[model samples]
Target: MKFKDYLHFLSYAKSLEELWSAHTEQMANFGFDKLIYGCTRFRTATSLGDPEDFVILTNHSQDYVDGFLRNGLYFHAPMLKWALHHEGAASWRLIGQMMQNETLSAEERRVYEFNARLGVTVGFTVSFTSVSERSKGAISLCASSGQTQDEIDAIWDEHGQDLLLMNNIAHLKILSLPYTAPNRVLTKRQREALEWVGDGKTTQDIALLMGLTSATVEKHLRLAREALSVETTAQAVLKASLHNQMFVMEA
Candidate 1:
């Protein structure tokens, strides 16, 4: 698809799944058949927050994801390290250079070897510019198996700017959509209670608004806190707002 046409499609994407499906197909057209995109708003100096809170979209196999993310291999990924501290696109050749220079630790080498076994050897990582100190976003575009770094680099050399822009636009669009973490989706009632709370309603006020008893209002608030994994209703309101789950329009 043409660049302008793709931009228009991305801007109108109404959900993460729809946006990701189109994005993966576009990347595949450029020889990158595997893609992993991740964003976190809870990053800290020492960590990227709970994995559950991360917005991760990928087309990689479950096995690769199980090991790379579920097993915590991302903490030791060399390119992820670079992405944390830098912005813009970077070649996977840096991994080779790190190995040649013996700068890779044992754990990092283990991640490398694991990728090698899975044929996830060559790729480019695009680290997006963070909007805040506690936010980070990035995407890794892995070339199809049997493709070499040299060939991938040539492709990048010609069309890297366009690819980078598309990924950035996609990232921004994702942040605008509602995202609920796994096992943390708030029910309609839970969301309504939180929205009322956000609007400065007390328990009795919310009960009147929703035609429920004050006790039931408290129950909904309590469940909202639990679902968001927060300790209090105020925290639940903030977390829900951050994920764009409160007062959202129905589809």
Candidate 2:
């Protein structure tokens, strides 16, 4: 697809599913058949916050994701380390250089070996620039199996700027949309309670507004807290707002 056409589609996308589907297809056209995009707003010096809070989008196989993300292999990925420290596109040739120099740690080697076994060795990684110290976003574009790093690099030479621009746009658009893991989804009443809390409403006030008893309002608040994995009503409200879950208009 033309670059302008993709940008138009991206600008109008209203949901993560729609955005990700189009993104994966677009990347595949550039020989990157497998892609993993991840972002975290709660990063710290030691951690990327809770896994459940990450904005993760991918088109990789389930097995790959299970090993790379669910099994925590991403923590030791060499590209992840690179992404954390820098911005802009990088070649997977760096992984080979690290191997040749014997610079990889044991854990990092384990991740490399796993990817090599799965034909995930040839690819490029893009680290997006962020203004906030605690926020980071990146993507791994794994080339189709049998493609050499040289060929992938050539593709980058020809289309790198366009590819990078598309990914940056995708990342920004994703952050603007609302997303929550299935287990973190709040019920309608739970959302209502949090919205009221955000608006500085007391339990009795929310009860009157929603036509429910104070006890019922408290129950909804408690459930919202649990769903958001927060300890108190204030934290619940903050978490819900971050996920764009409260006071959203219905389509």
Candidate 3:
């Protein structure tokens, strides 16, 4: 596909799954058959977020995902370390540099070894530009099976700029789509109630605005809080916004 053609296709991705499939296919054309994209908005001083809340899109097998994500080994991943502290693409060769220079910690060595066992040894990590301190997004481009690190780097030397541009654009587009984990989806009425509250409307005002009784509006608000697992309306609004569930038009 032409460069602009891929960008056009990316813009039309209506869901995360569609985006993931399209992206992996494109990466495969460049000899990076496996792609993993992870983003989190709920990062804190000591934690990233609830695992379920992360926007994780990958083409890797379930076993790899289970070990890397579900097993929480991603926290120790060397690429993740570079991604958290910097924005831009970093070659996985940096891992080797760190290892040889004695900069790799024991835990990082274990993480690298774990990834190597999973055939995740050769890749480039792209850390997207950040707009918030608590939000982070990155994509790992893994060489196709049987490809060596030197071959991947040669491809990079040839098309690294184009690859980076594609990923950055894809990341921006993904951020614009509405997203929420299955367990946190809000009902139509629940979302309406939250939207009203987000606009600073009180219970009575929302009830009148939505043509519902105040009791029903309160119930919707209560359910919205329950669905979001938040204790108060403020937390509900924040959570809903974080999930991009607020003020989106249903199709």
Clashes of each: 0, 0, 0
lDDT of 3 by residue, 119-173 (tens): 9989899999888988999999999889888899999999999999999999998
Please give the lDDT score at residue 220 for candidate 1. 92
TM-score of candidate 2 to 2 decimals: 0.97
Candidate 1, residues 1-251, lDDT tens digits: the string is 78899999999999988999999999999999999999998899888988888889999999999999999999899999999999999999999999999999999999999999999999999999999998999999999988999999999999999999999999999999999889788989999999999999999999999999999999998998888888999989877887889878888
* Model 3 CA deviation exceeding 4 Å by range: none
lDDT rank order: 1, 2, 3
Please list the Cα RMSD from the true structure of every candidate, rounded to 1 decimal place.
0.9, 1.1, 1.7
Between which residue pairs do clashes occur in model 1? none
User: On lDDT, who's better, 1 or 3?
Assistant: 1
- Among these predictions, the greatest lDDT belongs to 1
Best by TM-score: 1
Candidate 1, which segments miss by more than 4 Å at Cα? none
* Candidate lDDT (C-alpha), each: 0.94, 0.92, 0.90
TM-score: model 1 vs. ground truth: 0.98
Q: Please identify which of the two predictions, 1 or 2, would achieve the higher TM-score against the true structure.
A: 1
